[model samples]
Target: MYHLSSLQTKAIAFLLTLFSAGHLSGQGLKNYGNNYRDFAGKAYYFGLSFGVNRSNYQIVHSRQFIGNESIKIAESNDGPGFTVGIITNMKIGDYFDLRMIPSFSFVERNISYTGYTNLEDNMTRIESTFFEVPFQVRYKSKPYKDVKLYVVSGLKYGFDISSKSRTKRLTDQIRLSPHDFSVEAGAGIQFFLPYVIFSPELKFTQGIGNVLIYRNDLQESTVLEKILSRAFTISFHFEG
Candidate 1:
């Protein structure tokens, strides 16, 4: 079994309690009147999710890093990452909801730079694990009672819990204590059931800041690459 940390467990329990209370209150309100004037129709939901995140590094310009033998330079490319998290949703209106997705993700990137030689052969690798929180505002359209379509736009903040960099001449690994932010958008469909609600959503995230911590010339290798990370996710919700 996967044991959750104390903080994670507490967060999950809190979300569960909120959902349970909201559900009971909504039901009670519905029984009292044909149409509840207040957001009493509002409810909360919680779920577990796992997905893949694609990550890349944004180089500011061409630069070099001091190595044991030779100077190293490089560009960046997309790398595959993984994510797992707890999701919470709060009903905002008849056709809208607010969602919070707290997740732990492993992100990595490969940087290839031009060496002192004319041929571009130098490269390095940087990997990091992050704790991310995404807050989203969703617009849902339900033509029928059993089905709903939704679109969400959100912002995410990520804290670097672990980081390392590797190269040929030097294993220059630095631990960075920093956080990153990004903007995300996505759309998906939901199937509503009497017992549970199943939602499969796909989202895209683009980092707004530079991911590199070093002030070296290597940062300039790929200045044109603006996006730092991207992810596609599918999540399911169990309603109580």
Candidate 2:
């Protein structure tokens, strides 16, 4: 069985509320014409984004875990993270755009288990600082005054820039792969301000590869057959 942590649950709830509020409020809003009337005529536009994220590992236990007497329970925990990125938008059509975002993120994933003696040794923490680039195709609805709704789907590639597993002793550390890839999908509402378009987006990402680096020396690594990345992000984008 799979379960989400409290943090993950709350984040999902918050995003759902945001979506509901935007959809409800939009019903009563009057059309303000095109907020960025002449803006789409340009070939490209640039923007900046800042966001908070929750990240974790999707752990699949090996047969070793089931057979071992020392291991009682195994689970993964999600934690808070932050991201900052530069966005480049290329207009493809009236309702479609190509977006590329190069971002840096701080993330952490934690693993916990219960031993026969209920000791503290059952916890392992992995930290990563990722440099990620995501390429997405965005589809937008017609603007209703200053508001527009959009959906985006894409692929992201990431490299862990702050991974210290190589420099550390294998005996004491849980090692992970430095590279990862994920499928991304999201939806957002764009609110045009006086001078900028402010967008609040909710994005979901699921890693496609097993990022776990198994080792014979580490019991934690041996117990896990695979670990995939999972994340939820709420981003605020400022575009011109």
Candidate 3:
């Protein structure tokens, strides 16, 4: 027999309570109206989203690091950012919807190096204003009164439109390519109100290709192999 920890037991109990209250049980007749019906006849909708994100890089070391004296180790540090976007959603079936969001993200990411002989520990910062577009497919659970749970998966393309990158004023330590491509996945709960649907979502994006632009003239660039971008975002969407 297996045993559940006290914390696990409490977590399960809490989830059970929410599930019953939100999906399984009903209230008095006075509270039993369905807000979901308001949009039953609509095939499409538009929305706006705003979110906060934490962005970082995934670094892979190169062969040069084995004997490099200037850089002992290379790592990425998290940076905070914000996003604003427009959403377009189209119903594909009773349980599925196709979505596209075009957004702008203002972010800053850091790369730090451990010092070695003839060098001191240093950190480099990369700030970007990115224009991003993502295409996603969402699957929604059956509505529970005015609420529904959904999951989404998608692909994204982003381009850094920051002035520094365009004008070549970036730090001499390292440079990143302006283009980024990623895969995304997320989940959220939707609440249907009298006039609109509001959803709060959490999403993760992972870059599929290296964003590092190798600099042959810099030692800081030689200690690393590749850099990939990653971000975790919390978004709020409002639609009618």
Q: For model 1, what is the error of residue 164's alpha carbon versus the real structure, in angstroms, after optimal superposition?
A: 7.2
State the lDDT of candidate 3 residue by residue for 28-134, as single tens digits.
32242367887866899899999998888888898998898677878888889999999999998767999999999999888998887545788888888999999
**Residue by residue across 74-165, what tens digits does model 2's lDDT show?**
77888889999999999888778999999999987788887888563467777779999999998776666777777788999999987765
Question: For model 1, how does the per-residue alpha-carbon lDDT over 26-74 read when each residue is reduced to its tens digit?
Answer: 4423233212222235487777767765556544442223332233544
TM-score of 3: 0.85
TM-score, cand. 1 vs. native: 0.65
**Lowest lDDT block of 10, candidate 1:** 30-39
Candidate 3 CA-lDDT value: 0.80
Model 1, 175: alpha-carbon shift in Å? Answer: 8.1
Candidate ranking under lDDT, highest first, comes to 2, 3, 1
lDDT of each: 0.58, 0.81, 0.80
All candidates: TM-score: 0.65, 0.86, 0.85
Off by over 4 Å in 2: 1-34, 165-171
Which residue window of length 10 is worst by lDDT in model 2? 1-10
Question: What's the CA error at residue 153 for candidate 1, in Å?
Answer: 0.8
